[model samples]
Target: MSKAPFLLGAAFVAIVTGLSSIFIVDERDQVLVLQFGQVKQEVTEPGLGFKLPFIQDVVSYEDRILGLQTQPLEVTLSDNRRLIVDAFARWRIDNLIDFREAVGAGGVDAAQARLGSVVSAAIREILGSVPLNAVTSDDRTALMNRIRDIAGREAASLGVEVIDLRLTRTDLPDQNLAATFARMRAERQREAADEIARGNEAASRVRAAADRSVVEVTSDAKRQAEVIRGEADAKRNAIYADAFGKDPEFFAFTRSLTAYERALKSGNSSIVMSPDSEFFDYLRDAQGPQQQ
Candidate 1:
């Protein structure tokens, strides 16, 4: 019965020793085993691990990407405009020994803190060099790339690799928005006014051209009418001159007959006669021939 108790006690001690020595590391984790406060072994693969009981310590760090998001920062640009910027970064522990030496077992959190400061400083430096419009629109991507390059180098000394850095949001301060809108509105209004002035100038030119056309048309019509009247007058004068040149005595007799007919047709009557008058010669000749 005493031997049984001793065997049970030995089995308990062995169990304790086995439990203390055995450990497990997952695929996504790395563990550093320290002996007497010095690093003894590093288990980087997924498998069962062994260590000295009560004399070794294991520190585990994530072997996957970690994320760090920063609070929104109000930054001033070279143009003296304030902007709120929010950014984030992804990183991972590259050197476990160096990471542990520099910080502690809390590798990801410590790296995040250090990298956050570097990113903030880099952001300030880059953003402060650019104008507000450049930061908001023009070279934002390039600026971020340069910042990431600088931040990556800074983070390397902390035993971390900065995978990516991104801008989440960029905004103008509330106080500046109204002023920006007003300026935009004024610019648009000026453009509209310029267009209107151009339109009016074009319309005036068109109206002047139309007036000139009307004047030209009227002048052409008047010149043509004068030419036609002059042609008609020349034709009438030629006809009259030909008739008068052919028989001057007959032309005078016809003219005298037309004048006597117009005078007899009037309501008032007057007579003046002589036997030897040329007007009576035609009547006298007719009567004498009948008498003979």
Candidate 2:
């Protein structure tokens, strides 16, 4: 029984040592073997890996791309404008050995901190040299490329590859937003007033043109009417002259009768004259007057 217990204890120890000697490297992971806190080997490939039992330990880092979001930063533009900018980055560990050497025991967390600093510096440097309009324009793509290049160069020492860095949001500070909006509104109002004034001017021109057309038409009608009236008067005078030539006594009689009707029309009218006046000659004799 004593021998049996010793054999069982030895078997248990061997099984534990066997299990501890092997480690697994996943496809998504890069591993470093550390012995007594010193890097002994790097296991970059997936599958079974061997390490000294109990004395060695494996540390792993992500092999795939990673994302990071930076806090909003206030940047001063070349034109002395201030804006709040928020950015994000896509990056990956390009060299595991250099990354381990740079970060030491701090690992991914330390690397991220250093990389974020580089990005911030790059943002400030590039943005400070440009005006606010350029930052907000479509030309920002070139500016962003410049920032990425600067940051990428600096981050190379930290063993991180910056694939891309982009500004996710850019806005005026809270204190400036209301003022900017008010100014824009004022500008729009001014433009509207100008348009309204131009419209009024055009309307006045249209009204003046219509008035001139009406005056021209009325004057033409009046002129034509005057011409027609003159023609009618001429015709009436011709008719009277022809009648007088045909019968002088009859024509004089008809004219005297028309004059008597006007002088005696039904109204409160009176005329004082001598009874034997020439104006009453027709009334005294229906034959008008003795022929001259």
Candidate 3:
């Protein structure tokens, strides 16, 4: 009966041992097998793994690219401009042996803390040297490359390789935002004023040109009318001279009748003058007795 219980206990022990001796390393993880806190094996590939039961433990970190973001850091540019910059870095553990020794069981947290210091230092050094315009412009690519270089050099000690470094956000500090807006608004208003002034100047010039065109057109019309009137007067004078040269007495009679018609054409018209008046010369001549 005692042998039966012992045999059952033996099977139980074997089952437990089998379970504890086996572990798995995931495809996304890099595992370091630590025996009593000392690294014994580094498992980078994914599959089933084994270790001494009850004596060894496993620590894992991501073998793929990992992102570590830094809190907002303030930097002063060469032009004395203050900027708040937040950046992130893409990194992975390259030297697993060194990582195990330095980070121990803290894993990604310890690595991130150490890496953040390096990145912050790099940002201050490279970003602080350039002007704000450079950081805000296309030249920022070169600046990021330089920051990555500096950060990568410092990260090597922690068995980390920074593949990429980027500034996620860069902006003026909170206190400066209102001032920046005010300056921009003022600049826009100034430009608007200048545009209004230019438009007014152009309109004035157009109005002056139109007024001058009106004067020129009016003067030309008046001159043309005077020339037509003068031509009509000259034609009438020539006709009268021709008529008088052809027949003197008939021309004089026609002139006398025209003057009498003007003086007495209306019903209310009256001439309070003697019959011998020149105005009646034509009537008097018509009424004279017959002569040879």
Best by lDDT: 2
Give the per-residue lDDT of model 3 (tens digit) for 1-292: 4699999999999999999989999999988888978889989999999998999988877889999999899999888999999898999899999877777678789999989988999999998898988998955788999999999999998898999999998999999999989998999999999999999999999999999999999999999999999999999999989989898777877787788778878687667998777677667777532345
Off by over 4 Å in 1: 210-292
How much is 126 displaced in model 1, in angstroms?
0.9
Over the stretch 247-280, how does candidate 2's per-residue lDDT look in tens digits? Answer: 9877877887899888889899888999988887
The TM-score measured for candidate 2 stands at 0.82
Q: Report the C-alpha lDDT of model 1 over 107-189, residue by residue, as the tens digit.
A: 67777777888898888888888897787675467888887888888878888888888888789889989998999999999
Better of 1 and 2 by TM-score: 2
The TM-score measured for candidate 1 stands at 0.70
TM-score per candidate: 0.70, 0.82, 0.78
Model 3, global lDDT:
0.89
C-alpha lDDT (0 to 100) for residue 113 of candidate 2: 83
Q: In TM-score terms, which candidate is top?
A: 2
All candidates' lDDT scores? 0.84, 0.91, 0.89
Cα error, candidate 1, residue 91 (Å): 1.3
Q: Which prediction has more favorable lDDT, 2 or 3?
A: 2
